[model samples]
Target: MKQLMQALIDQGARLIGLVGLPPMGCLPAVITLTSPFSPRQCNESLSQIAIDFNQKLQSELKAMQTDQGPTIVYFDIYQPLIDILQNPSQFGFDETNIGCCGSGLIEATFACNVGSKICPDPSKYVFFDSIHPTEATYNYIFKKMQPVIDEIIQGQ
Candidate 1:
């Protein structure tokens, strides 16, 4: 990922923003797959991996940001997502453990079709599908990352 970003900078890109990975363990699909007793519970082991990877990515991005390199900004999508999951009510989310699509357990992509059962209110759910977030979740994430985006845009 760093190599690809550096390549883009070498091609005359002035501003480069890298979005770090989110909490993989918190995803409904991962929870369903990993947690046998409690599918709704987050798999801490997988989340740790994501956290470690994000930290390394931050370090690498910092190292890559030199005087001649493009204005590189690392957008953290992990912490805020975790915060939302921990306190769903604060973010106007009623459902955090499961998705809005199908059984809200394992449905994603092709499985989350028109035939699949959908929640009455998608805005109440953090995830639209087992593997993906809803528009509301995306909006919240965007708001959290907006400040960093502004800084990158202003070349600060």
Candidate 2:
């Protein structure tokens, strides 16, 4: 990621932005289909990893925020996913587990077709696919982060 950042710098990139990971618990498939054998992430290690990763992301962004470099940011994907999962009704939805298309409770995939079980409206779902956010989810994320984005881009 650092090397990529420097490469972006070399190539005259500006205004770096990121959309980060959401909480794992809220993913329907992750919750429903995840391997029980898969051990829970060690808190000590996960915390360290989060700290290290955040530091690195910040370092890379700060490095690029120099006079001749772009202002960079790591979007907070964690909270939005949490908020959506915790309060789907706030976003005009009644369910978070039900996807807008694909195999509903079984799987989420790109094979949405004529008979696929699509939700009534996509605007309310937290995720569009089994693993990705829908347009609605993306819009919500954008709107939620708009202030931070504006602040960062505005050099505030």
Candidate 3:
């Protein structure tokens, strides 16, 4: 991660925003793939991996930030996503465990087509498909990242 950041910096990138990894364990696809019998539950082991990686990346970014050179900001999506998944009601989400398309487990992309089964209201669901979030979820995520985005724009 540091190497990649350095590469980008070397290429004359001044301000950089590093987005943390979302909770893959909490994703419907991962849940379905990892726990077929109990698709509603998240795969903790996968989520822990993302958590550990985010911690290391955050620590590295903190160390990289100095008064002398380029500005770097760590935009956290992991914690906010986890919070939304854990407490869907807070974010006006009725369904957190599954997506809105098809079975809301493993179907995505081509499989989740126009003719495919979908929920009546996608806004109520956190995910649109197994791997992607709904517009509403992205809106919530954007709200969480707005301050950082504003800071970036203002700094520039």
TM-score of each: 0.93, 0.72, 0.90
Q: Could you list the CA RMSD of all candidates, in the order they appear?
A: 1.6, 4.6, 1.7
Ordered by lDDT, highest first, the candidates read 1, 3, 2
Name the candidate that leads on lDDT. 1
Clashing residue pairs in all predictions, respectively, total 0, 0, 0
Residues 1-156, model 3: lDDT tens digits: 778888988899888888888998989999888887843688889999999999999899999888865899888888888888989998899998788999998998999998999999999999999989999998888999999889889977
Candidate 3 has its poorest 10 consecutive residues by lDDT at 31-40
Candidate 2 lDDT, 52-75, residue by residue in tens? 665677666666567766777777
Model 2, residue 101: C-alpha shift (Å): 1.2
Per-residue error (Å), model 1, residue 64? 0.4
Residue-level lDDT of model 1, residues 1-156, one tens digit each, is 777986797799988778898899999988888884553699999999999999999999888889977888889999889999999999999999789999888899999998988999999999999989999999999999998787766865
lDDT of each: 0.89, 0.65, 0.89
**lDDT for model 2:** 0.65
**TM-score sort, best first:** 1, 3, 2
